[model samples]
Target: MNRPQYILLPVSPIFIAISLIAAFLLNLMPWGQFIAAPDFVALVLVFWGVHQPRRVGIGTAFCLGLLMDVHDATLLGENALAYTLLSYCAIMMHRRVLWFRISTQAMHVLPLLLLAQAVQLLVRFIVSGKFPGWFYFVESFVSALLWPLITVLLLAPQRRAVDKDHTRPI
Candidate 1:
């Protein structure tokens, strides 16, 4: 059996920072009242948490969550709590998640996404004493739906090209 091998590409810290920043910007975009924009920053955080736990972990998630909290004008630390838990879950499951195909990985991610939303909802309820209704949970499904796409786009830069010609001194 012939197996294809891939070169290991070097990951730069700057690239990860830029991706997080972009995600934050995306989350900040105005989408009107009708459409509840998905939490792009949280999604990106999970992606990096699973792929590069060492580079992006609990601290990073907490910081991003705080920024998101400020961006959305929500109760402070609400997103931080959710994001911290989400990142911890992702880090713990990173090894297992990497074994599955991107499509299959969504199944693993669905619960986590839901958990993050649930935490956020719980926090909101505690602070405001009101629920945002069923529609508020819609973004969790939307985030899960985009998981495969996120995996593909984020991993694109990290995929090392397989060299066909082997020219090495033996």
Candidate 2:
């Protein structure tokens, strides 16, 4: 059965908005060093990169990172540069990533997440003239570990909708 294309699939804007909001919330949350959460915005960008490259590319990543920088009151362009680099890496590996299973994609995403965090750390150090401590790296690890879960949870609704459409008559 041919599927109808008008099944109200959630678009890029929704994802972008949710990501930005999550980033802001994560930044605002007072974790107090127990468990350093991953950068929500970065994770979101990766998800979009893997799933919707045409709509959420490096430009979008850079913009979102800039917003993060502004929201967190960090050095201007620090997150932006990191995010831009991450986005580029994601796009470069987009085809391969799409071919991988979700679990495999999480493994693949680990390095990109780490890379983004490392770049951001470097930028922050350059701007602030000091290191942010080892805890900063925790975000990268956490993000990598959370990638599969996040991908599944966030994308499940869309997948279900698509499945429903396919099973239904046109």
* lDDT (Cα, tens digit) per residue for candidate 1, span 1-170: 24344454766799899999999988888882658668888899889988899999999999999998998799999999999999999999999998777777888887888899999999888888998789887887888889999987887776754554558421
Worst 10 residues of 2 by lDDT: 1-10
Clashing pairs in 2: none
lDDT of 1 at 79: 93
Winner by TM-score: 1
Over the stretch 22-123, how does candidate 2's per-residue lDDT look in tens digits?
Answer: 766776676734668678778878888877778789888888888888877888898898899888898889899876667788889989988988888887
Candidate 2 residues lying further than 4 Å off, grouped into runs, are: 1-16, 32-34, 161-170
- lDDT over C-alpha atoms for residue 45 of model 1: 86
Model 1 residue runs over 4 Å out of place are 1-8, 162-170
For model 2, what is the alpha-carbon lDDT of residue 102? 70
